[model samples]
Target: MSRLTVNKTYKLYIGGKFPRTESGRYYELKGKKGNLLANVSHGSRKDFRNAVVAARKSFRGWWEANAYLRGQILYRIAEILEGRAEQFEDELRAQGSTPAAARKEVLKAIDLFVHYAGWSDKFQALFSSVNPVASPHFNFSVPEPTGVVAAVAPERSGLLGLSSVIAPIIVGGNSGVVLASQSRPLCSVTLAEVINSSDLPGGVVNILTGMRDELLPHLSSHMDVNALLLCSDDPAEQKLVQGEAVENVKRVRLHPDAPLDESPYHILDFQEIKTTWHPVGV
Candidate 1:
């Protein structure tokens, strides 16, 4: 008698829970050599909207959480990822990465988390400024999270590119609804599992596996989403996002070529500067 192989089902992660797409749609994930790798949920506009709702619902709590606590959670995510390094390497290899490249990407993704963790509580202070004025007044500006964010993760270098775009957004307290790479989505789903055990609040970072071409416009035009992060090299996609973003004027950030970066600016890119003034008695 032969044993039956049970396949693992990859679903969308919303509110820290895994659920199949509401539309009951699915797509086949094929490897570089035309082997069936896995089945990923083909997320729909309704699915993205549901994730956005979850994100908005969880935003206040996550935004008001202790900065140090947020940093701790991010570091914890990295710790969990490190423990699952082999798993990620295997996923990367399944997604067409060479052994050495998979190892490097997994390592880089882990370090990227820690890098943003260190900046979590510090970027605000660095971006803040005390304004100079001749009048009897105290004036200053500080950075604040931009509420719910939506992103189209890079189409290539799935693990590392996904990490590079998301760590910066969430480290600063913004909740995100990100669309993972269409072809190389295995690592993205696996990372969602890592996040679930890393002390992160539900809905803080939702991951959806689907076609970026179909989701980019919805991510842009959605009024609830306060910002958009894009990592594709497609000029048409970029133009579509920018055009749709005018509906609510979401802060849009695009990285056409290899969106990998350790800079704090990426964190600030999703933030807004709030200035205040107070009268100082002479």
Candidate 2:
């Protein structure tokens, strides 16, 4: 008798656990050759709303965590990812990346995490400034986490693009809810597993897999989400996000068809500047 293979059912990573979509709807994920790969939960607006609530609940803890500790936690995520390197590479290959491309993306994702980990403790100093005041007071500005961020992960490169968008946002202590690539979402789910095993707290980063059109409107318009990071090429979608963001005056960062790069500016995108004044003679 031959043993039958059992396929895995992918679910949404919300709060801390993996739960099937509330709608109980799933979409078939097929490989490049049109073979069934897996059944991915087709996340709904309700799911995105749930994710935002989770992110909001956890924001203060993650935001107040010591900068060095945040860096350590991010580094731990990189360690966990490094251990699962082979698994990620395999998933990327299954998603249609050539073997070399898969390996490259996996390595790049790991390195990107480490890069942000290194920046976690350093960004504040680099971005902060002291202002000369005439009122006999010391005035200075510092960057603070913008609470909750909703990001649309790049649709092209599964692992690398997702990592690029996420690592920087959380490195500065902002918790995030990300919409994974609809066509290639395996790495995002796997990354959620890696995050779960790592020291990063639950709700610090929530991963949802589904259609962008289905999720974007809800994510962009949600009042609880403090910022939006979009990685897309669609002008219509970009316009829609900008228009909806007006409801909350949300900070919107649009990367229209742009390749991901290593920069501290990405971290700044989700940060709010706060200035403090101290009486000099008090």
Candidate 3:
């Protein structure tokens, strides 16, 4: 009898090619059974910038998309994700999740997708408000897409946390540069495939795996980035990212370092600012 061998390395998702990391830095990933899954490429600043350019190019069309259309696309993504729940669970298990926990995470992830999917149409109503400031002309406020955002997925609940942060921003019509969870990034890369297959235009959400300390600073301070979401629980680093966010006044979210459970209204936390302009005169 002959023994069979299989290749199991992952690729860097850039320019639509799953090429190996440009910097050639690779890291070992342990699986649910404590077995080595494969080596994941560690993205660098150059790679991050490349992803940013892709996002910026894709932003105009995505942002200009009608709210209902965007909602439909996002909802479609949720539908696809639900249909492919097993695939995500398999990836999660490869990242070291038990079957029960993987199922729970997949369900939450679907809910997270649907949650943000709904917001694609509703966030505008929730965040956009009419102001009666007794002004000379019809004055009101509206929330606009904040252009490109940079995100860091929570280190722990790697898959679900990444989805929670990324979905809201993109559904709201903003493009993003996301740093995948360093320890367990397989799910993030797989998510890129999900978005690619969905109605979402290219670059709506770009995922990169790399050292947080190395890549986050550039993302935070990058003048092109309009906002950021720090999903990690490290107060020191969180504070630093927030501080850098101030330079660009990037919107920031500091998620709690809690158990891998659903947080209430988590999607709302990152939705777009929608302000409606209307006349105060009756």
Each prediction's TM-score against the native?
A: 0.97, 0.98, 0.88
Task: Please write out the lDDT profile of model 1 over residues 103-159, one tens digit for every residue.
Answer: 999999999999999998899999999999998889999999999999888888789
- Per-residue lDDT, model 2, residue 181, is 92
Model 2 / residue 85 / CA error / Å: 0.6
Candidate 3 whole-model C-alpha lDDT, 0 to 1:
0.76
Candidate 3 Cα outliers beyond 4 Å, as residue runs: 1-8, 15-17, 32-34, 258-282
Which one wins by lDDT: 1 or 3? Answer: 1
lDDT per residue for candidate 2 within 110-211, as digits (tens), equals: 888899999999999999999998898999999999989999999987888888988998999999999999989999899999999887888999999998
Q: What residue runs in model 1 are displaced by over 4 Å at the alpha carbon? A: 1-3
Give the C-alpha lDDT of model 2: 0.91
- What's the TM for model 2? 0.98
Q: Which lDDT value does model 2 have at 88?
A: 95
Clashing pairs in 2: none
> Could you tell me the C-alpha RMSD of candidate 3 in Å?
2.9
Candidate 1 positional error at 244, Å: 0.5
For model 3, where is the 10-residue window of minimal lDDT? 258-267
